[model samples]
Target: MVRLIAFDLEGTLVKSVSGWVELHKKFGTWEKGKEYAEAFFSGEIDYATWARLDASLWKGHTKDEILEWVNSVEYMDGAQELIEFLKKNGFKIAILSSGLMCLAKRVSEELGVDYVYANELIFDKAGRITGEVNPVVDFQGKGAILRKLKDELKPELSVAVGDGYNDISMFKEADVAIAINPHEGVEGDHNVESLYEVKEIIEELTRGQ
Candidate 1:
């Protein structure tokens, strides 16, 4: 009796493995971005500090320029179909990612998602990157966020689908955890190679409910 589905954005619904990394690569800041990512993963820096460091790389870029980059991101195969299938089956959909809000917001709007939570890069009055950030989702905080969402939404059961290490937290919070093309060692109640397979899994889960 699943009432909701939470999905990771990059590498789950979207083709990019990480929207932040892709943006950094596009802006020629990947070298520094990679270092910051390593530092964060190694426990040398907190998420806020890491996010600030990454945001600073795009300080002078205009919002429109960043939006252009965001627009370039493509959806994963069967993303649209999977979302539509979930919606049609009367399940609330949520996008929970540690990626940037620029891309997450677009995906939510385009797919008509019910909820979304992701980090945000602040902008100045002239719409330029401000070297600041609103770190709404921490790489290791998905479980806490999901628990909060569960309390607020009160879904009888919830499913989480993702592919990265960060998603492991969400998987723990969800009633049904699905690892979609997961990274090494990331396990879930079920493992799938594609979003199409996710549809079949959901269909089976919802058969009697």
Candidate 2:
């Protein structure tokens, strides 16, 4: 029976405009930026260099400006209802994201979820973008945290839901993996196009309803 449900923040529960992507679209081709970005995220380059390049994309934007831009992000359809259902059913809900903590905290408070695991963006006292993320969590690192949570909770079963390549990494540690209308590929253990559909999967997975 599934007992805990973990979700990815961006492109899963809530989706916000990509600050760096927006900059690239305004100044140049997004593909050009993504080519280098993919490599950086894949570990071909150091995180510091990646931060420098990512920051350069924004040029002179203030950290608050960026946060405000993201604050307007919209949650996926049925996201609120799904969270409510999980909570009502006595399941542990966690937001597992690779997003900035500032934005993550905002979303967490809005959704009133239990726990949040994400990265932190560094800003100067002036609240200007410093172009650095503290302890960026991506790739296989997510699985490590989920595994630890599973051990601690000792739940009958653990589940993870998301729609990005990075999210698929948690499959090994989760009892069930759900891919929700993935923006890139359909390689998750199970795939769906709607949050309501995901709720059904969870309902069926849970042992006594």
- State the C-alpha lDDT per candidate: 0.91, 0.74
Residue pairs of candidate 1 with colliding backbone atoms: none
Top lDDT hit: 1
What would the per-residue lDDT of candidate 1 be over residues 1-209, giving only the tens digit for each residue?
33889999988998878778888988999999999989998999999999999999989899998899889889999999989899888798999989999999999999999999999999999999999999999988888888888888898879999998999999999999999988999999999999999999999988887
Q: Please report the TM-score between candidate 1 and the true structure.
A: 0.96
After superposing candidate 1 on the true structure, give the runs of residues whose Cα lies further than 4 Å from its correct spot.
none
**How does each model score on TM-score?**
0.96, 0.84
**Model 1 has how many clashing residue pairs?**
0
| lDDT (Cα, tens digit) per residue for candidate 2, span 103-128 | 77888898887878876666778887
Residue pairs in clash, model 2: none
Q: What is the alpha-carbon lDDT of model 2 when measured against the actual structure?
A: 0.74
